[model samples]
Target: MGSGVLCIAESAGNELKKSAFELAGVGQRLAGALGGPISGALVGEGISGLVEGLGKRGLPKVYVVDDAALGRYTSDGYAIALKAVVQAADPAVILLASSAMGKDLGPALAARLGCGIISDAIALEVVDGKVHATRPVFAGKAQLEVEPADLPVVVSVRPNVFEPAASGDGAAETVAVDADLTGEQIRVVVKELLEPEERTIDLTEADIIVSGGRGLKGPEHFHLIEELAAVLGGVVGASRAVVDAGWRPHTEQVGQTGKTVSPKLYVACGISGAIQHLAGMSSSKCIVAVNKDPEAPVFKVADYGIVGDVFEVLPELIKAVKEKKGL
Candidate 1:
C-alpha cells in the first residue's frame, strides 16, 4: 500500500483557490482513515509564500516546486512538477479540484504515473484501506462509485461540494523539490494568459445564483437577471436555450451541456426547468422558481414558486430584496 494522501493545490495570482482548502480537508480525512499524515503539493512560480497558509490548513508537510517556467500554467510543466512530488511522497491517493487546470493535468499526471483516475468526484471515503469515490454519471442522472485497481489512485473532486478545512494552530513542514524539466520536455509553451473582460464569481464557486431563461423575452432583458443577482450579491446564470439563441454567452449556461453548479440558493426566473437544466443545479440547497406557467416542471422541485410573468415580477422582487437588505 502507498503511504499518505497528497492533495494538489491550485492557485491564481499567487493566492490559493478555494478548492485547495477543500482538498486539504479531504486529504486530512483520508489520511486519518489510512493511518498516515496529510500532505500537499504546490506547483507555480514564487509559491513559497503560500506554504505557511497551507501548513495552518491541516497539512503536516507541503512539497513546493517554485520555478520561473511554471509562472504560467502549461500542461507539460505542471505535470512534470507534480510527477516529482508524487515520486517523493509515494501517496496512496491523490486529490485535485475539478477545475480547468485539474481537468487538464489530472489525466496527464495519471497517465504518467500509470494509475487509474476517478474524475469529478463528489464524495470520497476509505473503505478497508481503499479509496472509494462517488461521482455523477450518465449526464448527472445517476451516481457511480469507483475504486482504483492499483495504489496511488488519482481523484478530481467537483468544486463547492466539500467545505474547506479550518486553519490549524501549527505550521506545516515545507519541502523544496526540483522537477528537473528541460525545455525539450515541455512540448507546449504558453504565450499569454487572456482574462475575461468582466470577472465574477465562477458558477461552481458561487454560493447563490440567479438564472433566467426565454421567458425574459430578449437578450437585452438579461439586465433584469443581472440586477437581481447584484442585489442578492450572487452571480448570474442562464438556461441553455438562452445561450443557444445567442441571448447570453455559453459561460453563463447552466445545464447538462454546460457547467454544473451546486449553490446555496438557485433562483430560476422565467425558466421551465428542463431535465437537462435540472441536472446542473438540482443539487442546490434551496430553489426559488418564478414563471408564468404554474405547471412548469421547475415548480415541482422548487422550494418557493410564483406563478407570474418575469418582467412584472422581477422588478417587484428586486425592490423587495433591496428593501429587505436595506441596500
Candidate 2:
C-alpha cells in the first residue's frame, strides 16, 4: 500500500481556491502521521501556474493535467484526469474539499479506483496509520467516527472546517501527466458557463454568515439581511422556507438539504430554528439568534438570544455594527 497523501487542488480562473490550501494542510498532517510525503494533483486548462502555490502550501511534488478539454469542469473529464494522477502517485489517502465539484467528482473517482469514499468530513485523524473521519449524522444531532476498511481511501472534507496551510517559499516539482479523455467518455458536455453578474463570498467559505428565515415577512424585506451581512463583512444565507417561497435562491439556503456551514459567527434573524436548519449552522463558533418567540428552538443553541421583532432588532443591530466599525 502506498503511504503518501495526495491533495486534489481546486481552482477558479487561474487562482487556487482557499479550500485547496485547506486540503494541503490536511494532506501535510496526514502525510506526517503516515511517515510519507505529501503531493498535489492539479487538473484544469491553463492551471499549471497554480503548482507553485501548492508548493508554498508544503507539497513538494505536484502532478498537473492541463488540457483544453478540461477548460470547463465535467464529472467524467475530471474523474479520468484525476485517475491518471492517482495511478502515477499511487497514494494511500486522497483529500478533497467538499465543494460542489468535489461532491460530484469524489464518488466517481472512487468508483473508478474501487476505493472507499467518505464525504463531508468535519474532522480527520490518523489512527493506526488509517484515516478516521468524524462526521455529523441524524441532522447534526449525533456524531459518527468512521474509517474506510481499505488503504486507498477518498475523503471529502467540509469547507472552512479546517485551517489552510501556512504559506512558504519552497518550490514544487511539476509532473505533467497526460489526460486520456475521449469524447465518448464524457456523455454530457457543458456548452457555456454562466456566472452571477455580481459575485458574493460563497456561503460555505464565508467566515461570518447572516441568515434570514420566514419571519422576515416577505422577500422584498431581505434588504435588511443583506445590509447586516454587508456591515459585518459576511455573506447572506437563507432558510429552506425562504428558498422554497422563492424569497431567495437555493444557493443561499443553509440547512440539511442545503449547504452545511461552520462560520466563525452565525446570526439567525426571524428564523425559527428548525432541526434541519440547526443541523447546518450549529457547528458555527458563535451563534446569535433573534426571534420574537422566546422559546424558539434556535435559542437553544444560540450563544446569545434576542427576544424581539426582527424588523426592530435588525436595524439597531446594523447601526451598532456600523458604529463599531466606525463606518
Candidate 3:
C-alpha cells in the first residue's frame, strides 16, 4: 500500500497563497499519523522560488511542474501536470484547499488518477491506518465521516478551517517534472484575465469578514458594511439575498451557493441568518450578529448578538473598533 501525504500547493501571481501553508499543516498532521514522509506538489510557471517556503512549513521535498503554458489555471493543463507528480510520489492521500481553483482541480485530478475523492473536508484522521475524512453535510446541518474504499484518495479541505503551519528555518529539495502541455490539450483557453476593480483579500482566506444582507434595505446603505469592514481591516461579504437583489456583487456573496468562509471574526449586519448562509460561515471562530429582531436566527449561531437596528448599532461598533485600535 502507498504511504505518506502529498499537498497540492497553489499560488497566484507568483506569490504563495495562504491556503498552501494551511494544506501543509493538514498534510503534516496526517503524515504523522501514517508514520510517513510528507511532500508537496507545486505547479505553475516560475514557481521554483516558492519551494523553500513550503520546506520551512515541514514539506522537505516538493515536486515542481513548471512551464510557460501554465501561466494561468486550466483544468486539463493542471491535471496533466499533477498526474506526473502523483505517479512519481505515489502518496497514500492527497490534500487540496477547497477554494475556487481547488474545487475545479480536485475532481479533475482524481478522475485522471481513477481514485475516489472527498471534497470540502473539515477534518481528517487516521482510523485503523486508513485516512477518514469529516465534512459538513446537508447545508452544515450535520457532519459526515467518510472513508474511501481505495488507496490514494483525494481530499479537498475547507479553507481557514485548518490553522496555517508556522514557517521554520528549513529548505526543500525540489524535483523538476516537465509540464508537457500544449494548446491542443487545453480545451478551454482563457483569453484575458479581468482583475476586480477593488483588490481585496479572498473571502475564504480573510481573517475577518463583515457581511450585509437585505435587511440593509438597499444597496445605497451597503456603505455601513464597507465602513465596518474597513475599520476592522477585513473583507466585505454579502448574503444571497443581497446579491440577488443587486445590492452586492455575486463574488461577495457568502452562502452555500456562494463562497464558504471561516474567518476569525464574522460580523452579520442586517442578516437574518438563513440556513444556507449559516452553512457557509458557521465555522467562523467568532460570529457577531446585529439585527432589530430579537429572535433573529443569526443570534442562534452567533457568539454575540445585538438586538437593535444596524443603522444605530453599526456606528457604535465601528467606533468601538476604531477606539480599540486607536485609529
lDDT, model 2: 0.93
Give a tens-digit lDDT track for model 1, residues 1-327: 668899999988778888899999988998999998789999999999998889889887999999999889899999999999999898988999988788899999999999999999989999997888899887667899988888888899988888899988869898998899788898898897778788888888899999999999998998999999999999999999999999988889998888888888999999999989998888788999999998999998899999999999999999999999999
Off by over 4 Å in 3: none
Using lDDT as the yardstick, the better of models 2 and 3 is 2
TM-score, per-candidate, Cα-based: 0.94, 0.97, 0.97
Best first by TM-score, ranked: 3, 2, 1
**Candidate 2 C-alpha RMSD relative to the actual structure:** 1.2
Worst 10 residues of 1 by lDDT: 133-142
Segments of candidate 1 deviating more than 4 angstroms: none
lDDT of 3 at 218: 94
The number of the candidate with the highest lDDT is 2
How much lDDT does each candidate structure score?
0.91, 0.93, 0.92
- Candidate 2 off by > 4 Å: none
Q: State in Å the error of residue 191, model 1.
A: 1.8
Give the Cα-based TM-score of candidate 1 against the true structure. 0.94
Displacement of residue 50 (Cα, Å) in model 1 is: 1.1
